[model samples]
Structure formats: structure tokens, C-alpha cells
Target chain A: MNLALHDIRHNVSRFVLTAVGIGLLLMIVLGMSGIYRGLIDDALVVVDHIGADLWVVQRGTRGPFAEISRVPANLEHRLRAVPGVASARTFVSHNVQREHLGKPLRMNVLGLAWPEDKGEWVNLIAGRPLGQPHYEMIADASLGLPLGEKLALGKDTYTVVGITRGMVASSGDGIAFLTTRDSQAVQFDQSGEAIRLERAARVQRVRVNDVGRIQPSFIERGGGPSSSIPALASPMVSAITVRLSPGVDPAAVAAIIAAWPDVSVHTRDGQEQLLAYGMIDKARRQLGLFRVLLVVISTIIMALILYTLTLDKIHDIAMLKLMGARNTMIAGLILQQALLLGALGFGIAWYVGGFVFPKFPRRVLITPDDLWGLAGVVVLISVLSSLLGIWKAMRVEPNTVLS
Target chain B: MNPPPDNTPAIEVFALTKTYGSGNTEVVAMKDVSLRVAKGEVIALLGPSGAGKSTLLTAMGLINPPTSGRITIGGRPVLDGPKPLVDLRAFRRHHLGFVFQKANLIPFLNAVQNVQVALEINDVPARAARRRALELLDYLGVADRANNLPSALSGGQQQRVSVARALANDPNLILADEPTAALDSHRGRQVMELFRKVAHERGAGVIVVTHDQRSLDVFDRTLEMEDGQLKSSQKPD
Candidate 1:
């Protein structure tokens, strides 16, 4: 270390130039590692944020989070029957974009059961949670919409009653929650009027063409089981999120649930892997390739620089050997210089890499473990780089002194 | 030289031979050479190009290790029957100093650093090594160039740094292979005089292999090597 440090001091400019080149390459390695991590995080953001223990979806499907999952609404009742099962709820999520206060905001609208379910999916960052079964909405806080603002969804205009924080989906889009009935209506509200009248006529046994009369008979006024509102078409849900009690064996429970032909249940771990393996798998491989290429280029550059440095000192080395210096001593001198250069490059990369990230719109997270891992990598690279110089120095014959 | 030294010499070799290749194609570089130089004296080894002067110097330097014969330094047998009795590299480090044809200062290190690195290799403390290097540079009268890199110094100044480096280890014998071959006459004579002063004042046995006959007066004795054997040109005073 001492000899390497002295050599760097002897030729500061040459070493600093090599270090800068290595530092830039290292920044790319660190960035790729961070970007790879970010991609996985982004892909699983919704699953991770939903705080679900197990996700139930259609059979032969990895869904709700990774795929489109659908089951009959009564499937929740069946899931509750499983041993050690707590409660089950259904939600439907879809991407929506709208103008709020004159700026476009993209969002995911989740149809949730109200009263007992409002607090489960949405936590109020401001104002209040959903209080009404219809006509009230809670938006994501990042949407920047204030309470009492109105949002238009399909054919209905709903009032924003509250704001929720950190309710983003796997795509990093914020979410808004509405009542299950309202959600169902928004999802199908744009259907043909003739079809709606036909659906209503089938339920009421009257050829009523008026929208007002249909709502009075079917949507609003019916309290008795014999009322005129047509039953929802399949009234099926998008998917379900399940939370197991502590110490519950989730895999065992998932297996028991998967036995039903109409359902597929996945543990949280399985779902996370499915999302990474199925969705972000190719991206991780690309980043690995990028990291490997960067390292190869850096090694080539390091070898060239050290080789040049040794070539410049061949005569001096021959003289030293003739002066009775050992071959190991000369080798040590060159190797030490390479290690010192690597240390300098690592320091520069940490500084520049730390400062330059975060300005990127995508997250670039560098963990403490990640930085330490890279430090070890740099040390190994330095050792390998020294080989070129050592070989050159050792090949210098003492007869070169007489020459 | 010195009346054929009746006592055992500091450096001695007998019938030393070095041959490259064999059979149908062979080169007898140095054949049947014998010589001796005792302690605390200066000898000038003179020869023409390709006359095997360097081959003889390298053998005596213990680098090529003569194909056959015996060599001893400091009254202890170094080579016995073509096999070296002592570790050549360790023996070289602790007992010999060498000057080359060129100044050959390490380009990166300044003058004093070039000298101090020798002491450092032998595990001297940094402060003591620095002090010793500075003292040698001062004694060689190039102390002003102590902080200058070899590139900044002239040929004479660079050689002076090399000399300081050679003396830093304080070996018992010094070998100068064409040390003044690259310098002007004035610088060449001054370097030879410096070698003469070093041998006389420091009691180090110095042998300078040179082709420059102009600097013969600086040697206490002069000898000529032709066909790989030495004969006295001037008797020691």
C-alpha cells in the first residue's frame, strides 16, 4: 500500500486520469444494479402495498396482481369456509385518466365494499374516508385534488370526499376508491341504452323505456327481495386479497384453497416471484448483461493503462535489478500502484454516483450492502489489473542495463 | 595488480566459462578467464566492443553465473565447482553495488527517493532512510538536485543520483559497467575521479569497466582484458 501510494504521488496526473475513466464505468455498474432493483420494486408495488397475505384468483392463472383473475362473488363465502381462514374481500382495479382542476391525472379506481371496507383499502390523508355507498370518492393524495372537488367517471359525476396516501398500483399509478355498486355501474355504465332497458324489462316484467322509472323501481326504491332492480350480470369480482393470521401456514392454506377448480390461491412469496419472473424477468437479465459488459470494458482499460505505465519503466526496472533489487520487490511496486489507483476510482464513483442518482425520474436506490459489495468488486479488479504490470516488470532482463 | 595479491582476494574467479547453445552451433562468449581484485582499491577494466568485457563483468557480478569455475567475494566462497555456495540474489543485495551504462534513474521518483527506496527494501525506518539518502547525496555533491525528478536533472546529475542509490546499501564491492560511456569527457573524468575518491575514502573495492582510455589516470591501477583474460597495463602505486 505504501509503495503504491508513493508511485501515484509521483505521477498524479496519469493516475487521476485513469481513475476518472474507471470511475465513470463504475457509475454505470452501480446505476444498473440500482435500476434492476427499482424495476422489481415497481413491478410488485401494488402487491406489496395491498398488504395481502394470499391472493385468490381464477384457476390456472397468476392474477389479481400478475394476471386478470375473476370468480363468482359467492367465492368469498367458500374461501371463508377454509380452516384458519379469516375474512375475504373482493376488489376490481382499472386504469383511468381524467382532468382534475385542469390538469390530467392518471389513476387506478378500485371498487371496494363500503362502511366495513373503506378503512381496509384506503387511509385518509386529508378530509375523510368514503361515508356514502354511492356518489362519494376518495382519491390518491398525489393527484392533488382537494376535498369537495368533483370527478367525472363514465356517465356519473362523483364528489371527492377524501384523499389517500401511497395507494399506488404496480405501475406506480395512484388509486381512487368508490363503492362496489358505483364501481360496477361505472364499469358498465356506457352500455347501449336499449340493452339497459331490455335488462330492466326482464327484471320488472314491464316494457319501461324511461331511465327515471327504472331507477325508482330497480336502483333506488326497492328494499324487498321482490323489488324490480335486475341482478348484476354475474356480479363477479376482479380478484381477492387475503390476510392470514400470524403463524398461519400460507402455503398449506393456498393448497387447500387451490383444490377448487374455479380458484387459484398463491402465497405472498409465490405471487411476488411470479410477478418478478413473469413480468420483470427479461429486464433483470438485460441489466445483468449490461453490468458484465461494463466490467469487461473497465478491466480492458485498466490493463492498458497499467501496461503503458510498465512499458515506460522497463529501463528503470532493469537498472534496479542490476543494482541487486529482487524481482518480487519490483513486482510489488507495480501491483501496489494498481491497487491505489483502484481505490481512488472507487472513491470518485461513490461521490458522483450518490449525487447524480435521484434526479432521474425513476428511483435509483443504492443500499449500504450494495456499496460494500461494489467495494469488494473493485478490490478484486485491482488485483487482476496488476497482473499486466507484474508480467512486464518481471520480463525486463538485467542485461538491458548494459544495453 | 598489487603484486599478484599473495592473500585471498576480496573477489576471485578462475577459468570461468560462459557458452550459449551447443553442438553444431555454439558461441564461446567467455572462455578460461582468471582474475583477482583485493579490498579497498580501484581497478580499471579496459576492453573493445564484443571483447567479452560485459560478459566477464556479469559473471563477476554473479548474475550470469559462469558455466564453470569458482568465484569468491569477501574471503567466503560464493561459487564452488559451478554451483553457487551462497544465495546469489541475497549476496548481491548485501555485498555488491552496480552502476550501469546509462544513469537509469526511476523516472517517477525524485533523486532522494531513488536512493531511499534501497534502504526501504531492506526495511530501514523511513526517517533514517531519508537521512542516509540525503547524506549520501550531499557527499556526492548533488544534494541540490535531491528533490528534482530524474527528468529534470542533467546526465551528470542523474548519474550522481544513481551513484547515491548504489552507495545507499553500503556494500563491500562496487561494479561500474561503462558508467562514463554516455557522458562528455569532463563529466566522464569527474565520474571516474568520484569513483576513485569513493574507493580511497570509503575503503570500498571499486572496479570500473570502461572503454574510455582518457580517464585511465583516475584509476589506482589499470588492466586490459582481451580474449576474456586480464593483464596489467599499469602497476598499482
Candidate 2:
């Protein structure tokens, strides 16, 4: 015969209606938090799968994520020569969007040199890894690309050699693998008209300058503006990923590379920090703001509901006071109702999030830790919201019944 | 009215005075009002509007304390001159009950649960409280409506349920403010008669403040008030 249970039994519909209202609000709260967690997970999946101990990028850049980092492809040779460095690979990556089967698909294309042993970076769910260069590609299954599907990037078309699962960028874009030469051509190749104009400009400048008594035949024999370009010298790569020898500390090897004036070095932890805190900072903050706003809205709604309920029961409160029920008892009645609503709402939201969040276009990772944390917040909000009702109930004068 | 064979009164108020505001705005709601009632006595307090009848009822119920008074209930002195001599809330819960002008039955609870809550608030076990609530409802002739909410009952039935609630703790005194004000004459007399039966059979003293004089015959004795002063009591023929 506790007053809270008794009252709720008497007004079962109202209690249930209020619980459901708060439940939907809680669902949004849980959903936003899960999306933030999912964003972090999506960002780290590629980094985790790469399994490299250290990343070597251009000087004064954070990494491939924060800014454009271009290091000479030849740096891989110099990196392999460092003590405790087992292997180094030239890795190039870029964001690309193209129409695939009439739908615009965003992908993060990753290019690596062959025989680098980095082909194991992707977990193949179907078909084999990328064995041939240039025309074969491995794509994440999230792109809905089946094995043997041909996709065109820029001017080159490649067949999907393998389908991997759960390989996506921080923005939830599917990942694709390309050969080094093909990716560079897709990224840096200029249009025919622009290349012709540049070539004519180079030849005209050479003929006008006439340095070293060069002849027109000499320039034409040198292959018509091709020899002047540094094609055979060295190619540019996004970054050099380094693997350390066994029993060697990555920080020690990274320190040795940091001394190179032409390049900057990042340990595995530093790159992860760049991805989590720097690359995704804005999106996380936006989601964080939304989460806070939802929580505030929920608290205000609960408080208003409890306050209105207390107002509606003012007469009953005075009667209880007249019946020799203390202020503490009335306060307990309101507080208990609030906590009950909070518990029920959290339960509903947790269940609903588990059931429906997977259908969202973006990954929404609702973890057990998030549930516990959100439950704690809901309880705290319930207790604080009940304060308004408790105040109203306590202030009700028993003398009002006599008047 | 005196107790049968027992000298101690269920309620005793000596020189009770209650005032509102102070200085130039001072209004005395009760002026030197004094009275006593013994166990099993059912008394009616009749007065016109602003005659301080409600003020005296509220003071006796331990809700609004008198500015100056010595009050005793169930042989225990609970208040002394504007200050409490004991825990007022506990003393009230243990010894007193009240019914208001409206049935004032908690609208959310059914008739039986409404009565049961009173005993539960006083720390009575739930099962025993339910049983006692049923007994009180039966005694008040509203047991048939025990499971119905207050809104489903008529005015007289609600008052009867409220009376049953007032008796839930086996209190020594029951104070009701215009319990029959909302009922028709026939239903009003029935509710008044219920108070009489409750007092005579349960051995609890009852005081009802009302303006309805048509049901006066049900009281063992009736007291009148005018200008915050008590008049001599009238006894039934």
C-alpha cells in the first residue's frame, strides 16, 4: 500500500503514457551517443588493420588524415635501412567519389606498392587478395561491390578482385585498394589539353632561352618536353608506413626518424590521436552538442511533467497532510514516481536502440558501457527533476483542507 | 461531554487563542475558546461563516497551531501555547483523524486503498491495514463500494469512505470539517448518523464542524460558536 504504487495503480494509463514519452526521448540520447562511438570505431578500423608500428610523413604535417602528406617514394628504401626497422612501404591514399551503378559512391582509395606484403591489411570475406598490379582492386563489401564487378576510377577501369567486410573510413566511406602506379595516375594525371599546353610552353621556353647553344633538333630528339620532366627520378607517395623488428620499441625507431630534416614521424599512438581527436573533432563535437541538448530537453520535459502532476494532486496532497501524513511521505511519493518513470524509460530506450539502430545508414555502436553511463545520467536527471514536485508537495498546507 | 467511567478526556483545549497577522492588521480567529470532549462522545460544532468554527477545528486537528493554548488529546498534552509538547505529526497520526468539506478522498485511489493508506502511513503492515480498512468501510456502510474510485461514488458514499479512512488508525478523536456540506439532506443525515454510530460503537470521540442544522438530532451534544467565542452546548431530547 505504498502511496506511489497505489497512486500509479489508480492512474495506470497516465503513468504508462508518461513513461513512453520519456522513453522516446531517451532513445534519441542513446542513439546520439552510439553514433559518436561508431564514428570513432569507423575511423580506427583501417589504422588498426594496417598493423604498422610507425608512420613517416612529410615534414610539418600531422599525417595523411589531418593534412596532405607527400613523401618521396624512394624514402621507403632509406627507411628500411634504419636500425630496428624491418620493412617500410610507400602508401598513398585519397578520398574519391564516382558514380557506381547509377549511385554516387564515396570511397577512400588506398594504393600500396606490390610485394610490400601489406596486401594482408584487408580481411577478405570473398575471393582472393589483390595479386596483380594496375587493373585489380579489393573493395570493402560495404560498397555493395561484388567480386568480378568492374569499376572505373578516372580513366582506368579495374575489376573488383576481393570483397572485404568492415573496412571503411571515418566518414563511413567504403575502402578500395589500388596499385601504386595506377593510383598515382588516377590522382595526378592531367587532361590532354592541359598537358599539351604545358608541353608547348616548355618547348617554347627552351627554344627562346637557347641555353648551352641547344638546337631545335636537340630538344626534339630529347623527346619533346618529356626529358625535362623528372619521370624516372622519383615518384611521390602520401606517406611511408614502417614496421619495426621484433623486441624493438617503436618510439625508439620513431625518434631516429624524427631527426631527418625532410620528414616527420608518428608512432602508432600519435597517428591514432590525430585520427580521433584531430580528424574527427568537429563531428564529435557536433554530436556532443546534440547529445547535451537532447539531455537538457529530456530533463525539462520530466520536470514539467512532474510539476504538472503535483499541481493536479494539490487537493489530495492537502488531504494527506490533514490525515497526518508528514511532508516527507508526500515528498517520497513524488520522488518514487519520478524514479520509476526514469527506470522504465531507460529500459524502453535501451531495447529500442538495440532493435532499430542497426538500420541507420551510419554505424551506431551502442555498447554496454554506454548503456550504463546513460542509465546513470537518466537516474540523476530523475532525482533532480523530482525536486520540483517535492517542493510543491511539501509546501501544500494541511490547513487548506479546513478552509 | 464526560467520559464513561474514565476521567481523562479525549480532547481538552484550555484558553486556546489563534490570531492572524499582527499589529494593525491583527485579526483574532479564535479568542479564548475552551472546550473538552470525552471518549465515545459525538459533538457537532455549528456556526455561521467567519465564526472561527474552522479555525477551532484545524487547531484541534493539530494542523494550525493556536497562538496561545494548552491542548491534550488521548490523555497526552500535545501542544502548549503555540509550541509543540510532542512530535505533532506523530501525535496526530497516532491519535487524531480528519474529514474535510469535500469528501477529500484521494481521487486516484479506490475507496479501500484510500482508507488503507492512512494506516500504512502510520507504519501499519499492509495486510492488516487492508483488513482493517475493509472492516471500517463495512462499518460505515460503504464496503460495497470499496473497490471503486472516489469519482465513481456519490457525495454521501465518498463522505462515508472518508469517515472510514478517518477511523483507519483507531484514533482516539476524529475531526471532520463540514463532512455533509456537499450531500443532500437525506444523504447528509445518513452521513451524520454514521459519525454517531462510529463514535458510540468504536469508542472514539468525534467532532464535526458544519452549518447544516437539519442533522442535529444525530449528535450526542451540539456546540455553537459566534465571533470566535464558544456558546453553551445543546443536548438532544
TM-score of each: 0.83, 0.94
Q: Compared with the true structure, what per-residue lDDT tens digits does model 1 show for residues A171-225? A: 6676778887677677755546656565555546432536546555543323323
The lowest-lDDT stretch of 10 consecutive residues in candidate 2 chain B is B1-10
- Report the CA-based lDDT of candidate 1 relative to the real structure: 0.77
The CAPRI classification for model 1 reads as acceptable
User: Per-residue lDDT for B1-237 in model 1, tens only?
Assistant: 223222336588788887878997878777887877776677898877666778888887877777888887887789864588997777887778888778878777889998998777666788999999999999999999899988899999888888888888887778888998889999989999888777766667788999888878878778787766664467545
lDDT tens digits, residues A1-403, model 2? 6778877887889989999999999999999999999999889887898878999999999988788999999999999999999889888888888888899988888886786653666888998877877788889988889999998877779899889987888879888888887777778767778778877776566667765145666445333445355543555899999999999998889889999999999988888998898889999999999999999999999999999988888888888887778888899889999999999999889888889898887889889899999999999999999999998888888777654
After superposition, candidate 1 runs with Cα above 4 Å error:
A77-83, A95-235, A245-256, B1-8, B23-25, B80-83, B227-232
The DockQ leader among the candidates is 2
Clashes of each: 0, 0
RMSD values for the candidates in order, in angstroms, are 5.5, 2.6
Best-matching candidate per lDDT: 2
Model 2 agreement with the true structure over B101-184: per-residue lDDT tens digits? 788888879999999999988989989999999998998888999999988999888888988888888889999888888889
TM for candidate 1 is 0.83
